[model samples]
Target: MSTYTVTSFASASPAFTETTYEVPRELPAFHVFVDILACGVCYTDLYRFDAVPGSICGHETVGTIKDVGPNVNHLKIGDIVGFGYLRSSCLDCHQCTSGCDIMCKERKLFSHGPGGFAHAVVWDSRFVYKIPSSLEPKYAAPLMCAGATVFAALYNNNVSPTARIGVIGIGGLGHLALQFCRAWGCQVVALSGSLSKKNEALSFGAHEFLNTKELTTETVKAQPKFDFILNTTTGDLPWDLYLSLLNPNGILCLVGFQEKPLEMKSNHFLYHQARVVGFLVASRGVSKKMLEFAARHNIKPMIEEYPMTAKGAANAMQNVRDGKVRYRAVLIVPQDSSKL
Candidate 1:
């Protein structure tokens, strides 16, 4: 059997080092070998989650199938595919039988090894998705994770045209949230700490922009209160303050993590009859729907692109770490390989 060469970046505590691996030609029956075309760098790849030493950390991977196992009949070689953080789950669990296997306790993450940071990777056929050929490859990367995340926040919650939607942060996830909310026909309000993004947010389809620095209770009350506020901010925020902006029975969907716990007064949610709920990335089912929705609405994320070399991956990481990225950061595989 021939050995295949793959380039990968391994986390060595304070840093990432590029390394190459050689694997046997044989792969497990449920798996498929994918030649990666692009990978999106997410905050979770750098700060949120931990991966073992010498393992690749990327989860939003777009590629074309290079090989399929005997047990996998749903996919074939040369198929354009995208895979997210979910690697595998025990199919016998109740959640699996209920067709909501993303919530399975035995769910596995692709970050453990063979992540999309490499030129080639392997994943379970069940969790992989076929991307529309019409979609640009780089856009497909972030759609697998970030796009699916915010879309799920809106989709699962039953956000509607009449619902006033407020998006916080206006960065990686929030920007996409704003666009999706607008396309969904909801009146969108972009909330931020400063006014720097007001124009961009408006250009992205927000009907109104709220600069928190200049915000007042009277100003908030003057506008339509939010029926759904999607908080995509990644740090400690004035949770109670945002809660006050919600209409009665409104939902504040928390999709980002905070290092510190959020504290709120009892009456903050009680008096308004508001709810605070959070969600992880979507199930494979919802992800498919999000892809279709994005295509129909032309809801592509604003992204910064880099080459797919080791240096390129490192640059993407640095850009995300320094908060210099405009929006999503994607690493584009070289042309010779993307054609495959």
Candidate 2:
């Protein structure tokens, strides 16, 4: 009954374009229709665009159920839910059957097509998750992707409560990682390029701060601290010195997507017997658990919000790519989007 446009990112100048499309009153038996209240702008949305030009690009979405299919029994009208990177995954895959749907080989991503840039999204019910009633939609939007990614890194690794943890690069992921580590009872240290976020990181419960700009490789090599070092920055780093900062048998977890391939001496990992590992996003259950934990702990992203119109979204994406957004950028769709 509602008519709205599906916004798409393209190869043309100005980048974002729109097309008017009507929402069918009845959804497919396997789908759930969502009234999108907010959608988060992510770096992946911009990085992966060449693969799906002219397709809708948002993946972090929070909304209410507007309509439900006949087969959807668990969710009902007016329920609040969130959608992340996964659009739909084959339910019968080994990964799906093994309680690792996020790793499903047959999973289709929402990186393209029918993305909810407008008022609503009709999507696979399996990928959607209910949000805590008290969580704000705009704040909850990033929880679907950015928050889940770091929370998975911390949760899946079984970081000890007494461990000394260091979070590198106090940007989108590091900011949240510091808080999660602190709340998990670890003594958190933030390593960043400048002291700009020192006070903020302390306010977020970090116990110590290290400005990487001031610490030389020799200084860090002499300092055998931190049980775990989480590298959350996007650029190449002094990976060797970081490995040196770890204690014996310590783990260095990489969650950032860097442009250049990094290099480090095998001795750093061999002599001390340290580990270098990577983490992906979490399973649906973990995602929900993370949100619940965030809600309970009052952990939230520092975000700058933009309206859902084309121009607003365009400016937000530019700021994100430019690294001008404070911590995160969220696109706030109108409460009643049908009017636009």
Candidate 3:
């Protein structure tokens, strides 16, 4: 095994730098070292750097396993795999045993544990998933996190192909949700704050594009109510407007967390029997199912790739923070074979 390894970190308040770190020559049971091919940069990574120092950040990663432990049978060396936000979960927990490992009380994020920013990482084999042969590694990385999260949220809500789905926030998550909803035979509406996203939304299979700023209770009431509205924004909406857009028994799923509380008129919900729910990245079980579903449907993220070197981390992080990334930013690590 090679003794040299590389890692990226927040060099200053908001900056990152690449530096070499040490690599273990062997593996322990339930552990495997993977040579990372791509690491996706998401908004949550920024939240970690807000008050801390020297935090290793990155969870969405796709790569090849270099070594495996004797106890691990489901995976083997040289297998192309991907791991999401979590690295460890207590198997005995209700959530884990029930296939909801994302909610396990003992869940530990790789960012908070040993993350995927390094050239090689030691991960629990149970948390790693083999990539579908049909998907490219670079595009598959973000799907492990963003893609899985949205897919799980919809699945958890029991969204059917006949459901009328509206996706709010046309950024990374919204784009993927639009495609998934469309592929499932649902009529999708892209709800955005800017008029600029109208064309982009339509191109992504949204049957309708409505500017949130221009929408009001009366205006929305005139249109057919959506069976489900997936809110992926960082701020609260005029809840009355969203609640009004729902048909009887419709749901509003909050996938994005805002700093402020959402304001709503209780009467609107009480009269319509509307419900509000929230979700995060799914458990390992759901992630696996989502991947299988995606593979069958040919649903994939629109990715912008970068190298795993210092320069690549900087460019991708900046694009993510500025919301300039087209959809998702995936960092590619040159394989050792590439160096040859």
Candidate 4:
């Protein structure tokens, strides 16, 4: 059988190492081979570094389809596509049938094989979405993961345009939340521990900016309550304090992952009938809709580019770890990779 060599950055050693895998010519039904052009470096990648050693770890992938299986009629060669955190899920489950594939018990991640950190990837076409022509590949990469996350929270929760939305942590996910909420005609409040990103947050569509570090109980009481508060930071925040800021029946949604167990008074939510929910990445249908909505509204993440090399990948990871990236980091593949 014919085979192709795929080069990727693997975490086999302390840092990333150059590795190659041989992919067979024959693809499974409903699968496609994608030539990765760009991939976004997410904070989740950092968390997975130590957990899955010797694995390729990138999910926010953007590329063009190079080959397709016989059953893949919707996607063809030369079509620009993107893959998020998920590769596929068992279609027989209730969650999958209800359009909540991300919640499926048997869902597969793109990181299972040669991920987007490589020059190419093969994924189930059901989860791979087409990129809109208006959006650049590098810009669309972040949307595959980060954008899908925040958008799913709002869309799935039935957040209305008239709702008062508060976004905590103006980083990768938080930044996109601001733009999406604002474009949806909601009143957006940007909440952060510092004012370092005040101006940028405003430009991204926040109607108000609050420095949480300086927020006193009295000051918090004076502010208006929010209908929905989305927390996108990994930091262990003052949960009770944020819960107090919610309006009656308001929702506190968490999209960030932290190791520590969340602690908060039950009475705080009980008294106000408030609800707390943890959101994973977007479902297949929601992910596809998010791309279309982002393209139509021109919502883009502020990103810094790095070359798709072992050295570049290491540098980008360090920057993300140190909280140095402006908003998001994207790795760009060289155009001459055909020679590889």
Steric clash pairs (candidate 2): none
Candidate 3, poorest ten consecutive residues by summed lDDT = 4-13
Q: What is the lDDT of residue 237 in candidate 4?
A: 82
Model 2 residue runs over 4 Å out of place are: 1-13
lDDT of 1: 0.84
**Per-residue accuracy of model 3 over 1-340 as CA lDDT, tens digit each:** 6453545444344566665566565667888778788888887777775555566678888888888877889999899999988888899988888888888898888666656666767788999999999988888888888898899988898998999999999888898898888888999999998788789789888999887887875687677789999998887678888888898899999999778988888876789889999998888888898888888888888889877766777778788888999888887887663311
Once fitted onto the true fold, the runs of candidate 3 whose alpha carbons sit more than 4 angstroms away are 1-6, 9-11, 336-340
Better of 3 and 4 by lDDT: 4
What tens digits encode model 2's per-residue C-alpha lDDT throughout 30-145? 78888888888888777655455565668889988888988998898999999888777778888887767888887777764567556677888877888888889998898888
Clashing pairs in 4: none
Runs in model 4 deviating more than 4 A are 12-14
Q: Where does model 1 exceed 4 Å of error?
A: 13-15, 48-53, 337-340
Candidate 1, residues 1-340, lDDT tens digits: the string is 7767887767665556777887666878888888888999998888532446666878889988998888999889999999897898998889877867778999997655678887888889999988876778799899898998999899888888889989998898988989899999999999998588899999888999988876676666676688999999888877777888889999999998878987987796678888999988988888888888888888888999988776777788888888889899998888675322
Angstrom error of the Cα, residue 75, model 3: value is: 0.8
What is the clash count for each candidate, in the order shown? 0, 0, 0, 0
Q: Order of candidates by lDDT, top first?
A: 4, 1, 3, 2
Estimate the Cα RMSD of every predicted model relative to the unseen true structure: 2.1, 2.2, 2.1, 1.1
Clashing pairs in 1: none
In order, what lDDT does every prediction score?
0.84, 0.81, 0.82, 0.90
- The candidate with the higher TM-score, 2 or 3, is 3
